[model samples]
Target: MLNKKQTNTIEVSSDIAQVIQDGQQLVAYMAKDGQVSLDPDLAQVMIDAKYKLQKKQWNAQDEAHFLHSYDQLAKAVAPVSMESIRAISRSDNDKPSQAEKAVAWYRRYTLVALICLLFVQVYYLFGHALAHDLKDLYESRNEWHLKLDSEEPNSKEFKQIQSKYEEVGQRLDANYNLLKVWNRIWLMGFSFGSEIPPYSQEKLNVELRRLERAQADANALDNLNLAQTRLTARLQLFENMLFAQSVLEVLQGYVLPLLYGLLGAFIFVLRDLLREIRAITFTTDSEIRYRLRLTLGALGGMIIGWFLNPQELSGLASLSPMAMAFLMGYNVDVLFAIMDQIIDKLRGAMAANDGSKGKSIQGSGNG
Candidate 1:
């Protein structure tokens, strides 16, 4: 009976034989002398077959066959001029170097960011347009007259109405202003929700009656009702516009940034997965190390994006554009760094506060 090693060798031999049989046509085509020219079709087939074989576990015999077949095909096609070789759009063997991969990833994310920025630009445009529309709506003689009659411009009641109106308009405009890049960038939103009129006739009438009482304008009651009704309609439109803008902000701000962050994290982690899991702090494998660095850098970029994104009170009201997306995709690391600093500051403040409290207690005990 054969020993274990001997049995394994026999099995390997059988596998090699089977491979050889399977690749009979490939071998025959390559080995044929003066019969098969390096025709483009044959070249393609040889390359394909060679790639498939390389993917499998090959014994010495299989390796030998591969080398021989490859050499034969190479020699067969040697006479074919380089100019005659058609450029293949893509190939499995065409593995890009680290630098090439980096450039490719950078470009890909940059392009994605640009697209997001474009969407943001449109969003801002919508905002600016909406602002203008609202102004126009409020500017009509009937609308203006009703507002004027309800309360004097300088009066507290009139001021309250003006304040509320300006607050909404300014919120929209402030978002646009904050979003501007070098005082030039702007954006807009796509209305994504159904328009629902906020004020019913009964609601408007009640509100108008209250306004009439505030002004005691029994003579202008009819005009005030009409003007208030119009105002309600405009406010409803404003709400719809804001809803649409918020949806886009969530997509561009939260969803896109999160996806980008996850992508970068996964890519970086996958590159050094084995080594990272293996606990090899000092890596000897240059390829693995390089991949790890590349992925980590990408993830870092994503973190920075999150940090830079407006987290201020007015951030939600701001436009989410392609520029922000690009920043988020490429500078995610910066964002993380900022968050780390904030956390550290908070920790320090808490420690100081605790120390102060301890001192106070000590002083009290001494007294």
Candidate 2:
């Protein structure tokens, strides 16, 4: 609402105030021993300007004369003084507006939300990995069990399978301990009254010992088979329970990529926001843009997860889908650029197809 003349007056006033303050600080700096040396004439001019400014009797010409003297003194004594004055002037003029304050307030809550979301994603990811590893161990155990069934109890192959099975069991026990800890800390409520009872590693070990003892008795071979079957069934049930608790089906679909994308976007936003705050360049005007960027990042991540197969790409074969999603989210311009390239390729292919169709029709008509 401020007109040009009023804005100019305000600017001049601000500049004059800054000049006065800087003059005082420069004089103080010069007073300090071995700090700075100013030409006598320039020093006098600075003193006169400071006096005039303090008395509020400085005209435009007086202000200009003082600025020229300050510049000369700065060049001779402290080269950085002029730049510091300019920075101070900028800082004074660019005070945070109401909108910026509001944005800052909202950003605090946004930060909290992002942190909470990050914790959840990390928790789910951990659970997913644990469940997956446990499933692999269970499958390996099943394979070894099959091998044991085919071998004589006292044979080398049987002993080897038994050894491998025990190793797998030890790993399973370790994983079970981890699960117990995880459940104790995170799933206390779910654990207390859950319909799916927790697996007992101690009972499983007892059953295994019983099976090993009965393996030498030919009459108890059927009992051994039954015991193995029961163990396999229990292991399978535990695996299912783990996968269920992990929400593996949902995570494997699109949620994981979305979460990773959000994480990437959050990281990028936090870094950018901190930089802007440090630089004193952050404004509410860009807040909406940041939110949009975050949304785009999440979408980019989901898109990458759904369509982009890293294994299919030559150099990207080692990167996982989640990693790709995160990268896309962190820098959505990359995703946009990639999509543009894909669109161009599709358009070119369609054009070629259309041209070929036209040529074929013309040939048929001529024939």
Candidate number with greatest lDDT: 2
Q: Give the worst 10-residue stretch by lDDT in candidate 2.
A: 189-198
Show model 1 residue runs off by greater than 4 Å: 1-113, 140-325
True-structure lDDT of candidate 2: 0.67
Please, what is the TM-score per model?
0.36, 0.50
lDDT of 1 at 173: 55
Candidate No. with top TM-score: 2
> When superposed on Cα atoms, how far off is each prediction in RMSD?
14.8, 11.8
Score candidate 2 by TM-score against the native. 0.50
Question: What does the lDDT read for residue 147 in candidate 2?
Answer: 87
What is candidate 1's lDDT per residue for 1-367, written digit by digit as tens?
Answer: 4364344332244554454444444345335533444555545545554554555433455456555665565565444211112121123577653334443654575467446645655665665565555445445434544675788778888877676666655654554343332122213433323333465656666867787678866667777667765665555555554654565456554554444544444444344443432232222243455455445544554444444545452753374533344344343455556678889999999999999999999999999
lDDT of 1 at 224: 67
* Model 2 agreement with the true structure over 1-367: per-residue lDDT tens digits: 4464333331248767787677666665566522456567776887787666565556667777888877766665443353333332335468855445644655675576467667767766776666667768879888888888999999998999899999997896676666555555444435432232335545555666786776656556566567656666575457545645756566655776776777677778777866655443455445766788779888888887555667777988988777888888889898887778889999999999999999999999999
Evaluate all candidate structures by whole-model CA lDDT and list the values in order.
Answer: 0.50, 0.67
